[model samples]
Target: MLTAQDDLIGHQTPAPFATSGAGDARFTERYWYTAHPIDGSELLFDAGLGYYPNKDVMDAFAGLTIGRRQYNFRASRRLGGRPLETSVGPFRIEIVEGMKRHRLTLVENPSGISFSLEFEASFPSAQEKQNYRERDGLVEEDLARVSQFGRWRGWIVVDGRRFNVEPAMWWGQRDRSWGLRSEMRTDETRPPVATHRNFFWTWSMFQFETSALSIFLKERSPGKPHYLSGTEFKRESDGSVSHREVVAVEHRIDWANDPLGQTIANGDLTFQFDRGAPRQVKMHGLPTRFYLKAGMYGGLQGWTHGDDRGDYYAAHDVWNLDDPATREVARTLSDHVIKLESAGDVGFGISEYGVATGYPLYEGPQKFPAL
Candidate 1:
C-alpha cells in the first residue's frame, strides 16, 4: 500500500528536471504524445520513447494514421547521454520550457517520416496517486506519473510531403512515467507465474476546448476489481486552475472476437468525478487501426528487444490489416485510438487493452467477461 508520504517523497517540485529513483532491472522512463487535427482531418500521430536502465537501451516509435493507411517507424540503440536530454538516433525529445513545454523532433530517416512539433502545457501537470503492491514475493512499484493536456505547434512531414500544424487547431496530451513494470524482467529461465496470468489496462486522456480529462485503470486478472485513478482539469476564466479526482467509473464494452477468438473491446465508458456531474464518453474503435496486429504503431511483438547489444530490432513496414498470414503472427497487444464523445464534446485518445497469455512469464486460459 502507498501513503501520501510515499507519493511526495521522490517528487521534484517541477518535473522533467531529473529522473526518479527507479533502480531496478525493469525501471523504465517513458514518454507518450499524441496529436490530432481539429479540422476534421482523419489523420492522427502518435509517438513515444522508452528508456530502460538495466538493459542500457533506449527505443522510440512514431506513427501516422491517414484514413485506412498507417505508416510507422521504430528504432532502438544503446542508451547514453543525460536522461533529461531525450535522444535516440534520429528521434529527440527536448524539454524546451521544463515541465510546461516540450519539443519532439524526428530527423529524416531512411523510412522518410519526420516531424518537429512543440507541446505547450495548458495546465499544471497532475500526478496520479502512487501505487504499491506485492505479488509472489515481488514488490511492484509504480511510483509516479504526471499527465497534462496541451496544444501542439509545428509540422509533420510524411515521405517528404509537409503538413503545417497550427497551435489553435492542433491539440494533444502527454504523460511522463517512471516505474517498475513486471515485463521488465531479464531472467528467461523462470517458469510462468500465476500472477502473470491475465491483465486489463486502459490509459486515456481527452482534450476539450476548456478542460481535459484522463482515466487510468489496471486489472491484474479476470474476476478482479480494477485499480482506477484519474484527474479532470478545468481552466477558469480568471486564469486560475481547478482540478479534481475522478471517483467512479463504469464501462460498457462491446466485445468482438477476432478471427483468432481473442476478445476485443469497442464501446463506451462513463466517469464520475468527486465534485461534478458524471460524464459519459463513447469510443468508436477504428476497424482498420487495431493495435494487436500493428507492427510498432501499437503492437507488442515488434516493440521489445533483449538487453544484449546485438539483440535489438526495429520495425520497418506496416502490417497488412486484412492478411491472415501477417495478422496471426503480429497479434499480441491491443492498441486503439478511439473516437470519443461526451455531451457535445468530441476528441480522441488510446484504449490500450491486452491480456498476456501463453508465454514464459504467463500461460493458460484466463476468463474475462464477454460482451
Candidate 2:
C-alpha cells in the first residue's frame, strides 16, 4: 500500500520515500474469540491483526468492539516517514515512517459492553494498482507496480490486554509515484516491500466491499491455478441495512510457532463458510500469520500487499477456523479447499490460505472478480 508523491529531494520538498532491507521481515499477531451460542461466553470479543515489514510491506484490519465478548481489537506499527498525526475525538489519526500507509480501522460502540470506538478513519492517502488493465483500464503488464507512498493508522485495545500500543498508530508508506492517474510514465520506487530475490506464484482473486458485506477469496490450485485470492463485496444495502457473505478456501499450509507465524492451512484439504452473527463473519482465524510467515531455521516469511490489497495487518485479516498453527510444523501447511458461505439478512465467508515455491518478482495467472 503506497501512494502520494511528487518527488524532489535535492530541490526543496519531497524526500519521504522509504523502505529498504528486503525481508525475513518478522511480524506476528493473533486474536480470536467468538460466542453467539447466546452471546454467552462473556458477551463479545472479535479481533484481527497481521503485519510484515518485509516481503513487500504488509498491514492488517478487522472490526467489532465491546470488551471481550464478541469483538474488540487493536494492532500497530505506523511510525512516520517520518509521520505521526492524531486527533482522538471522532478519530483522525496518521503515523508514517520509512514509507507509510498500510493501516485499518473500524468502530461501532452502540454502548453496552464498551471496548471503545465511536467513529474512526486515518487516511493521509495510500492505495496502489498503478497502471493495471483488463476491463478497459488498459495498462496491465499483468498488473504493474512501483511508485509508492501511502499512509494510514489507527489503534486502541484495552480491557483484556494483549500487547503493543506506544502511540496509538494509524499508517503511511512511500516509494513515490504521483502522476495523478499515470498512463504517461512515472516511476519512483516500490516493488520491494518484500522480496526474497524472486519466486513466481500467481493464481489470483481477492476483492473487498463496504456497505454491509460481500466476500470471496478463491483459488482452486488442484492441477495448477494460483491467482492468490481474496475478495469482499458490498455496494450499499437498503434491504433493512443487512447483507453479509463468506467463503474460506485453502487446502494446505504448514510452518508456525512464530518466526512470523506460518500455519496457513493444515486441515487436510480445507473448507469453511458463514454469514452474519460473527459480526457479519468473513474471517479466517482473525490473525497470527499473514504475508507468508515461517521461521525457526528454514527462515521464510512473506507479505507484500502493494498490488493493492492496500498492504497489511491485512484488512479483515481472517482465517482462524478451528485453531492449528503451532505444535506441528512442515512448511506451515498451505493446501486449499476452504469454504465459508452465507448471504443476505447477514452474509459472510472466509478462506485465509496459501502455498509457494516461486516468486522471481512473482507475477503469474492473475484474474479475479467473482462479482
Instruction: Point to the candidate with the largest TM-score.
Output: 1
lDDT of each: 0.65, 0.25
lDDT (10s digit) by residue, model 1, range 1-371: 12233344555534322333444666777788877776667667778887775666777878776665567787777644344446767889988897798999998888778999999997778888776667687786665788888889999998667889888888777888877754532122332312334455567777677777888776664323367789988789998889989887766566555554334346667778889688888877654343422323322442443243343455556555556655455443434556677788877665665444432212221332110
User: Going through the candidates in order, what is the number of backbone clashes in each?
Assistant: 0, 131
Model 1, CA-based lDDT: 0.65
RMSD of 1: 7.0
Query: What lDDT tens digits, residue by residue, belong to model 2 across residues 1-371?
Result: 23232243332323222322222232222111111111111112222222222323222223332221222122233422311222211223233242333232334322211222221222122222333225366432232222121112223443334322222221111222222121211111322222221222222211122332222222333423233222223444553322223344433333233342233222222323355334222222323222122111121122222222321121212223233342122233221112222333321112333333332111221111011
Report how far off residue 318 is in candidate 1 (Å). Answer: 2.5
Off by over 4 Å in 1: 1-23, 80-84, 184-199, 219-224, 256-266, 286-306, 310-315, 329-335, 354-371
lDDT score, candidate 2: 0.25
Question: For model 1, what is the alpha-carbon lDDT of residue 362?
Answer: 21
- TM-scores for all candidates: the values are 0.76, 0.24
